[model samples]
Target: MKLKELIFIATGLLVLTSCIRKEAPNQEADILRCILPAEILADKSIDYSLPFDTELKAYPIYIEVKGETNLSNLAPQFELSTGATIQPASGSYQDFTSPVYYTVTSESGTEHRPYAIIIRYKQTEQIPTDYHFEHVELYDNYYIFYEETDNDGRFTWASGNPGYALTGKASSPYDFPTTISPDGYIGHCAKLTTLLTGSLGEKVGKPIAAGNLFMGKFELLNALGDALSATKFGVPFYHRPTQLTGYFKYQSGPQFYEDGKYTSNKKDTFSIYALFYEKTNEMPFMDGHLPANHFESPNMVALAQLDKAQTIETEVWTYFEIPFDYTRYNLPVDTDKQQNGEYYLSIVFASSKDGDEFRGAPGSTLMIDEVKLIYE
Candidate 1:
C-alpha cells in the first residue's frame, strides 16, 4: 500500500487496540496524536536568465507527498502567500513558483506545510557594439550562361533569365546576375573562426569573442530618383536611375567550446564584428546597428548599391543597412564585367580585451546562404 494508505491503516489499528483495551478516560488521549504534512521534493529557490524578446517564460515545478494521514478522503491543496496574504495556485504549471502554502486536514489532526519556489526569466538584451568581418568570394564557383536544347526547359531569373544563363560557378564572372539579384542578391561565406600564431610559435584557432552581425552598401543613384548602380552591376537596370539597397539577418553568438567541451571558466567570452568598404582602405563605408539603437533607411532603392563586409563577436541578433547618396561613391548602373581586376573581401576576429580565453571559438562558423539583387 502507498505510504498514505499504510498510515491510515496503522492509525485505524491503533484506535481499535485502544478501544478494546478500554480505559474509557484514555480514549480521548489515544485519538489525540500529531500528524506531519507531506514533503515536497523540489527545491524552493531557482536561478535562470530571462528569455529574449519575451515578457515571461514558463517552466514546471514538482511536489511530492509522504508520511501519516487520516480523514479518509483528504484532499491536498497549495496556498500562495508572502506571509501577508494567502492564495492557491490554479495548478502547478498554471502559476509556477509564485509563492505557495500546502495544507492537509484529517479527522484526527491538521498539518500545514510551507514552501518557496524560484521563477526565472529569459535573457533579453540589446545587440553589442564592436565586431570584425570578412566577405566570401562570389566567384568561388561557376554557372552556365545559356544554351538551346530540349523544349521542356522554362527559364526564370533564377534559371539564368530571358535570353542567357549561368551556373553558380560559371556565373562567377558576373558579381550578381539579374536572375539571382531581386530575391537572391549576393552570397558569400564569412568565417567566425580564425588561425592565430601563439607566442610559442604554435598556430591556434582563436574564436571570435562577442559581436553582432552587420551589412553595408555602396549606392550609385541618379537625379531622377530612379534605380542606379550597385556592387552587382552585371544585371541590366530597368530604371534609368534606380536606387540600390542591401539587407541581411543575424542571430546571437554561440557559447564557448574548449577542447570539445563547454566550460564556464572565465576564459571563453568572444565577440563578432562587421563593416562595409568601397575599397580595402576607405573608411568603413557602412557600420552595423546595435539592438538598443534605433535604425531606419530613408530609401528602398539603395539596397543594390552596397557591397557587404561583415563580422561576429560574443553577441547575437542585430541587422543594419546603409544609404547611398548619388553625390558620393558614384556607382555604375550598367555592367562592370571587365573581369580583369581583382576585388577583395577581408575578415578577422577580435579577442575579448577582458573576456574569456577558451581554446576554440564558441560558435564561430559563419554561414552566408542567401544572395539577392533587388530592383525596387
Candidate 2:
C-alpha cells in the first residue's frame, strides 16, 4: 500500500476507537450507578397459612441499599400494582404490610427505572371477625303463612328446568331419563317457600325438610335449575333438606315417587337448604346438605319475592345467636360478642318418601328479594 493511504486509514481507526471508548464508560456508569430496592418471591408460591398480626389496613416498608454505590440524598418509594400500600421508609430496610403488592421508587428526585422489591407478610393466628345470621322469619309473621292458606296462588313449573333469563331465554334440560317439564304441585311448592323460616334450634341437630322439591339450595343453584324423581315410603335422598349461604341466588331440584308405596297412604317428602363455605369457589366450610352441625357464626334467612317474569326481590331479617357450645372446632376468638367474625346464613329444604313415589318437573322458579346483612 501507498504510504499516504496507510496514514489516512490509521487516522480514521483512531477516531473510531475514541468514540467507542466514550460510549463504553457511559454504559458502565449506568450499570454501576442504578439502585434497586429489594426483591421477594412471586405471589403464586406464597403460603397463606403463616402467622400475622392485624394492622389497620397498610404496613410500613423499608429497603437496604445493597451496593456501596452511595445512593445518598435519595429516598425510596414503593407501590403495589394492585391491592397494597406503602408508607415512607423510616429506615434503610424496606418494610411492607399485607396483602402483597408491587413496585418501589427512589427518592433521588429524578425519574428512572425505579427499583422493586417483593414484600411478604407472615400469616398470623388473629382470627378474622365473622358475620352470623342467627334468626330468620318471613314478613314478621304478618303477610302470608303457608299453613293458613291452601294454595296461596303459587305454582312450580319447569321452563326447561333452568327457567328464563332477564333478557333472553337460556337453554335448560328437559325430558331426561328421569326428568319432567314445569312441575305444578300444590303442597310441594308451599313447603319450598316455608323452609326459609323458623327457630334456630329446629335446624341445629339434624337436617330438616327443605323447600319444594323443584327448588334447591341457593348455593347449588346460583345460576341454574334442577330436576329430580324419587319413590318414597320415607323420604328419598332427592327430597332431603339442603343448606346454603346467602351468596346463592337461585336453584331447582325436583322429586317424584312410584305407585303402591305406603300402606297408610302417606304422601312423599322433599326439601333443600343453603350452607356456608369458608373460601370462595371451594368446598363449603359448613354445608346443610349432609346433617346438622354446630357452628359459631349466625345464619341469615331471607324473605324474597319473584314475579312471573322471574324477577325476585325480598327483605331479609337477621338474628344473632351464639351456640350453647362454641369452643369446639377452632372457631374465631370471640363468639360471645356480635361483631367479631363474618356472619353466615343457611337455607334448607326437606321431603319424605312413602309407599308410592312423587315426581318433580322442570321450570320451577323461586325468587328471593331485598337480602341485606344487618351487622351489629
Candidate 3:
C-alpha cells in the first residue's frame, strides 16, 4: 500500500465526517420551531383531547407546523410525569401513529400544561355526507360535537361554543344557551336559547346572547374584540349543497333590544342558513368576523336562507328544508369541488335571525334536530 495514497484517503474521510457533523445538528436543532401553535389543532385537520391516559382511543393525527415540512426536525421539550416519556425525545422525529400526551414545561420552568394530542386526518370525500348531530361529548360545557369517522373515531365539528364560553363563567352544560337536549326525534337535539347577561354584560352593551351553532369555530379572543368578527364559519365541503333539511322549533322572546337599548317589541325569529363559498385557494379558510358581510363576500358561491314564515313557535318538532340559491358558481353545475376543493360550507343556527347584530330578545329559543345536508 502506498503511504501517500493511504494519507489522501484518510484526509478525505476526515473532511466527510466534519461535513456530516455540521449538517446533522442543523436539521435537528429546530426543536422550538417545530412546536405547533395552539391554533393549529383548532382547525380540525387534527384532533386534540384533554386528560392523558384515558382508555378512550384516538388516532391518525397529523400535527401541523408552519413552514416546516419535516415534523421530526424539532421535538417538543416536555417535562413528563412519573414514568411518562415523549417518544423520540426532544430534538428528534416521530410518526404520530398514536396519541402523544405530556406535561409541557414552561419557558421559565415554573409552570406546565398537560395536553393529550390526538389526530384523525379528515380524508376529504368526493361525495355528499350527512351530519345528524347525534354524536356529542361534554368538554368545557361546550359539547365537543363530531361524527364518527370510518376509523372508529371522530371528524371534528366546529361550533360557536367559544363565543358563549366568553360569557359562560364556568356554567354547566344544562345552563349553557347551547346544550344537548335529552329530547329529539332521533337521539338528542341541540337547544339554542338566548340568555340574559347580568351586570357584566350590561357594561359592555352585550346584555343578551342569541344562541348559535355553526359549522366553524368561534374566535373567542375576537368575540369580545369584535362580536361580528367572533364567528368563524365553514367546513371544507366538496359538494355544492342542493338543500338543507332539519327539524327546528322556535319561539321569539317578547321584547327586542339593540346594543343594550330597548328598541322594539318585534318577536325574535330563529335563523337556519348555509353558506357555500369558493374560498381563495391560497388561504383556504374564512377568518373569524367574516359572517358580518358574508352575503356580500367575494367568496359567495351559493346561499340557502330559511324563510322566516316557516320558523314560527310550533313547539311540536316540525320539519323544514331549504334549497341552495346559487347567486354565483365558480364551477359547473354538475360538479363537486374535488378538482381542488377550495370552498367552505357553513350551516348556521341562531335563536334570532338578526342576533348576529346583537338585536334580539333575551329569551328567544330554537331547538334543532336531525339536520342533514342534501346535495347535488
Candidate 4:
C-alpha cells in the first residue's frame, strides 16, 4: 500500500459520502512527523549510519516513509548515486571508491533530503583481543571509540549522540558522555558521563539522559517517539562468554530529581550489567523495553549483572567480576561454530541506574578501565 495511493482511495470514499453539513474537516495532514530515511537497509546484518557509508563488495538499499504521506499521490523517488548503476534501475549502485551522494524525494513532493554515501571496504577480525578504548576520534568535542584500522572504521560502540543533539545545547557532545580520561588506570580509558537535559528536553519530560555506551546502533525515530524504545541494545557476537571483569569508580551527585520533582533523601545508584541473548529470525536485538520486557523476551540466553550497592568514593579504581550465568535467564547452551553472529552480547554501565526512566542527578560520574572479557 503506497502512501499516496492509499490517500486517494480514502479521499474518494470520503467525497462519495457527500456530507451535507459544515465544510469537511480540513483535509490537511500533519507534517511534523516527516523525517529522513525512516528505514534504510540492504539486509538485516548491515548496520546503517545515515549520512552513512559502507565498504561491502555488493550493496543495496531500501527506504520507507512516515507522516503526510497520505497527502500526495506521487511515489517516493530517489536520485541515484552518480556514476554507478543500481539494481532496480530506478535505485542506485556505486563503485564508492570515492565518495558518493544521493537524495530521496517524499511522496508529497514538498520535501527532500540528500544523503552522503561513502564506500570503502576494510576487513577486520571478527572480535578484537581487547577493547582498551585507547584509540579514539573527536567529533563535536566528544570522543568516539575507534580502536583499530579497518576500511569500515572499527568503532563497535554506540551512544546517545543523536538524541542529545535535540536538546539545542552547544555542549551536546557531553550529553553522550563519551570522553577520553587521561587518568585511566592504564594509558587511556573510556569515560561515560550522564548529562542534564537542556531547556528543550525538559519541555518533553525527558529531563535527563544517562551516559551509555552499548554495542548497537541508536534509532532516531524511536528516540523521538519514546526514549525507551530508542535504546536498541546488543550487537551480534558469536562466541560464548565466560566472565566479564572491569575496574570502575563512581561518585554520586548531590541532588536527585524525577518526573519534575525534587527529592532529598533519594540517591541514584549505578548499573553495570551484561546481556547475552540469541538472535533468531524472530528476535534481533533488545531495546529500551529491556527493563520492563526482558523477562518476557524469549531470546534471553544469559544475563550477568554487577551488584554494587553504593557509590565507591575511593580515589583508586576498584575491581569487579561478574561470571556469566546462562541458566539463570535461559536454557543451557552448546558451542556451535555456525552460531557466529547469531547471538548478541552487550555490557552497559550507567552512573544513574534509574536513568532510563529520565531520573537521575547531575555530576554523577563512573570511570572504567582495563575491562576484560574472558571466554571459555
Report the number of the highest-lDDT candidate.
3
Comparing candidate 2 with candidate 3, which one achieves the higher TM-score?
A: 3
* Structural similarity to truth (TM-score) of each candidate: 0.19, 0.22, 0.71, 0.71
Between candidates 1 and 4, the one scoring higher on TM-score is 4
* 1-376 per-residue lDDT for model 3 (tens digits): 6999999999999998877442221111111222444543324233222122235332122454433233333344433333333334643544444556444444334444445444333445532355666778776566766777565666655555666666655367766667677787678888888877667666666667777887766656566657776676777777667998988887778788786677675777888888887766444556444556546666677888888678788778899889898845444443444434557788888887777677788788798888888885
lDDT of 4 by residue, 1-376 (tens): 6999999999999998977776533322111211233333212333343323233222223232222232122222333322322222232334333434444444444444444333222221355525676876655445566566344547556667667667766353444655667778887877766678778888877877777776766776666577787877876566788888888877777788787877898887777777887776566678768865644577788887776553455567888888888877665564562253557778777777778788887667778787777876
| TM-score leader | 4
Residue lDDT tens for model 1, 194-270: 11212221222322222112232212221012111111111212332222222333332244445434556533332
lDDT of 2 by residue, 223-310 (tens): 2221122110010011111222222123332322223121233223322223322211132233332232222333222211111232
* lDDT of candidate 3 at residue 149, scale 0 to 100: 59
Ranking by lDDT: 3, 4, 1, 2
lDDT of each: 0.25, 0.24, 0.63, 0.62
Identify the runs in model 4 with alpha carbons over 4 angstroms from their true place: 1-88, 91-101, 106-112, 115-125, 149-153, 172-176, 294-296, 309-311, 334-340
TM-score for candidate 3, please give it.
0.71
Ranked by TM-score, the better of candidates 1 and 3 is: 3
| Clash count of each predicted structure | 87, 103, 3, 1
Q: Lowest-scoring 10 consecutive residues by lDDT in candidate 1? A: 156-165
